[model samples]
Target: MMKRKILVLKYSFLAILLILLNTFNVNGQDEFVKKSFTTADPLYTNLLKATEGNFKNYPHSFLENGNIKYYQIDEWTGGFWPGSLWYMYEYTKEEKWKKAATAWTNSLESNQYNTKHHDIGFMMYCSYGNALKFDDNPKYKEILIQSAKSLTQRYSPVVGSIQSWNTRKSKGDINLWEYAVIMDNMMNLELLFYASKVTNDPVYKNIAINHAAKTMQNHLRADYSSYHVVNYDPKSGKVLHKQTLQGFSDESTWARGQAWGIYGFTTVYRETKDKRFLKTAVKMANFFLDHPNLPKDKIPYWDFNVGQPGFKPDWDFDPKRFKETPRDASAAAITSSALLELSTYVKGKQKQKFYNAALAMLKSLSSDTYLNTNNANPYYLLKHSTGNLPSNREIDVPLIYADYYFLEALTRYEKSK
Candidate 1:
């Protein structure tokens, strides 16, 4: 009798799983064909013009005719935005699109890729990650796996979190103590999680959970605002410094980092069923919703805590002493995509509001005046974008990721509607 009951229970769970998969059409014929910004919509057309516009400089990379080409956006090999045009290809299925994505993915196989940043999600997941998961393109899976391995190998048992940026003053010297964690690293957790899934080893999951927990403990303030970086001892996992590497948050909150925290925690909650992570996501998201300083445009300045209207920076707070914060469309686009995901976890009107806010941001982003309508510039985006202002790269243009997520949010909005 006991054996029979156990069998029944197992089958019942399997039946429910079948039902959910059927309901969501998880294996349906339709792939998540990426959407394009370049409809009759001026936003997309203008972006193409802007990014492709300048005769001397174009942020171009791709494999074509059995060769790869990369142009210098500047001193930095900056603006590697394959993820942006990947979706454009999804919509059009043009040979050029495939060639472009293929070239970018192939180049890394021969070169030492940038492995030590929180932006693996922005770099790989948005491009190769999606390509493998949705399209079953085995071509990119090896690279994605290599990418995950690269990120995971950076993990230090002493710090108990993934090493984010490499701080090597010399070549071949591994004494790099400079460690920091950014909210953007949260999306990269998927890389580790995938590694765990494929290897059937639990180590990756544990590392992901631990990294997230540490971020919550060390990087966040009481009101759910966040700092951009937490420096730590790699040997002992000690907090060495909490600095705002990006925005206002050595003591103030970066709007983009806050958005990343909210979105990333929500993702962790989805994976682990951790109540604390879910609650933290809610807390930070609500803080964002409640801020009165957001412009009529839902898009935010790169740092919300800076330059509140009618309020002067304290004498100690000098805007001129530091670089003025930029308005980051890329950050806004990532935040909106996160909110769409968060809606899946809430109920009724509570869910509706989060859903609406995300939609509002999309509407504002793809607007005619805000979009990059200049045919001279081949990038297909509009307002509030900055790439490598520190390096004076693409000072204000429609970033590739901005275009990617803006398209993603619009597609998600289309589905929810």
Candidate 2:
């Protein structure tokens, strides 16, 4: 009789423990969602107030000297503002956010035909892509198809890659590059893949596959760390240069560029179901996550090797001026969103690792250290993003794209739960 009583007590205790754990988990997610909105609602509300319905002047970044910088509709980051608005509409189902997102998304219609740059995907997909998720407008699909067509105009049959930047002299007369492809260009291929799916044409998908294959071969190192720019001979498809235009040196890894690789390749794997792309994405993700220089908070410095021995760049900045290197919240945000999607593709411990890492990054980003609670930068969301640090531009400021990805990560986190 005493043994039976003991077993009953043990089982009761186990049941209570499980209940408590489940309740705590649910409450934790609720708290995160509550906090996210509490911070974002005011900042985005202020953004709309400041703009006063001006769709042409997209919010880009908050400058160091206390000014809200705006980018034209044609800029690389033009879509992020609208993308964030779309996320807001998705979360709240509020008409104001939807109306604002529609107007801002409509402002960038001209970018569908922009063939001069390789960032049309970033400028179009991020906005219209998210818009279509809520409303399946045929116009949105047609616009995206046209954007993909324009992007294909920059592809080289010989190089098997999309040209990132046109031939131009550097600071000096450095025209050694006939064709340049940056790691960031991996992101633009999604538009082409989407176009192929909608149009039932393999031409766009074939171009994207060729570009991904060539990039996998030439742009990534043995450790999967990527070069910022890989220059190719236009006529022969020969890799002319594998160097850095935005990192600490020719050899150092740029944090945002690495984040772009993780996000881009994961996206490719999603669209293609190619195991090679999945393997590459996993390797690149591990490289970023396992790097010793990655801070405890998961937000990384502008360059992974910054201030370390033998990693100096020939830029004009004074290293001594900054007591600690600047962190790129944008990198963390982008990686967090990518990891959430990647977690769905894997199972067991790998899935848990990615999911937990993404949560940690989101936690750090939502904290007071990174979240813009005081409206110091009224036009932007998160702070301490490094954009083009070597060129002395947009350092340690609030960037629009950082906010877009942060909101996106939060949305993905909620859905995964």
Candidate 3:
């Protein structure tokens, strides 16, 4: 009887093992790759698809109810969307993408879209600069001029800086934080400067210069790290406070914020030839690079303060978790591009250090484990990027900004080669 029982147990064990084997695609292989997924593969693919790949049946932007929303859908922007689309266009000389981009460019009137925020540079640099580069459509120039005018109109005579996230409903009282200057604001300064050139107006240039100078003085700390926001008294334009509202602390340097600082300061240096901006950029870059808390591969966390054991995350913590918390390769990709640009301005040994660091970031992003081209979502390069932190979600997924910098760096390197 004991022997009989042992035989039954053995057969049952074998049957369970067989069931387990068939239950999962434990060793499933991807359709187009010899290896497994990497973080950057899907990002790379998305960029290509936005431009090149079979976009014939491309679905228009989807609505919440899951309907197709095509271009010329009024609220949808075809102008800003073309920034990535143009990348593919540049590569393939494809006219279809250009046609799509033009639909949005033709849609504009006045300077309405020129938002009263730091993202103006982002909007115009991508949309208008693209139009200027490819089609040389003179109308695009007008659109850019109008956009800059709208942006310049927001400059506060009292604060001596542009107000971000403002709502007009405040009854002449500013609803948005008046003293706030994000690292991304570095991009906005260019629009003012660019507008200055277009309209032959020095006021716009002065606005840009003053805002940058004020930010440099108030936003940066003695440690070379920086804050994400600076609150100022709108009347006197004096700084009331500086803090990291978007990051781990008013004091903690968010990885992406630091990346923005690096990119923004470098751009400022290029446009204004400000040695102080250059010096500050280098200081922050060193702080980022020398931090021992970064992942072994050099990619950073969504928050630089991430990964510490005592760091109890909050309900609003959206610092790029992938099953477990992971590093933000998007930040790494952005910094890589910034470092590349910064190297051009730096000299001798400093130049080599920045360049090498940038290349290292790119190399780390290119590794198999980081990109995800092999799996179903095979195109995005960087991974674990957050779209918004308020909801505490989109953990470890591809973000549009990540793709932007990744492709830009790739293009820059490819063109150089």
lDDT of 3 at 269: 85
Worst 10 residues of 3 by lDDT: 28-37
Per-residue C-alpha lDDT of model 1 across residues 1-417, encoded as one tens digit per residue: 999999999999999999988867633312222212553135434434444533233343222242222353221222234555565555566766665555554444422255545555445666666455336766566566666766777677788788777664311222343776666677778766776776777887888899899888988889888877777877678887775545543576677678878878987898888989988887888777777756667777666767665433222445564363567777777778888988888889868878878867776676654555444243345445765333344445555556666766666655664
What candidate 2 gets wrong by more than 4 Å, as runs, is: 1-10, 171-175
Tens digits of per-residue lDDT for model 3, 40-68: 33443454455453322222232334233
lDDT, candidate 2, 213-313, per-residue tens: 89999989999998999989999999887777788887889999999999999999999999999988888999999999999999999989887888777
Candidate 1 error regions (>4 Å): 1-36, 39-80, 92-96, 111-118, 168-177, 308-326, 374-376, 387-395
Can you give the TM-score per candidate against the true fold?
A: 0.74, 0.96, 0.75
Question: What local distance difference test score does each model get?
Answer: 0.63, 0.90, 0.63
Per-candidate Cα RMSD to the true structure, in Å, reads 11.9, 1.6, 13.7
Error of 3 at 227 (Å): 0.7
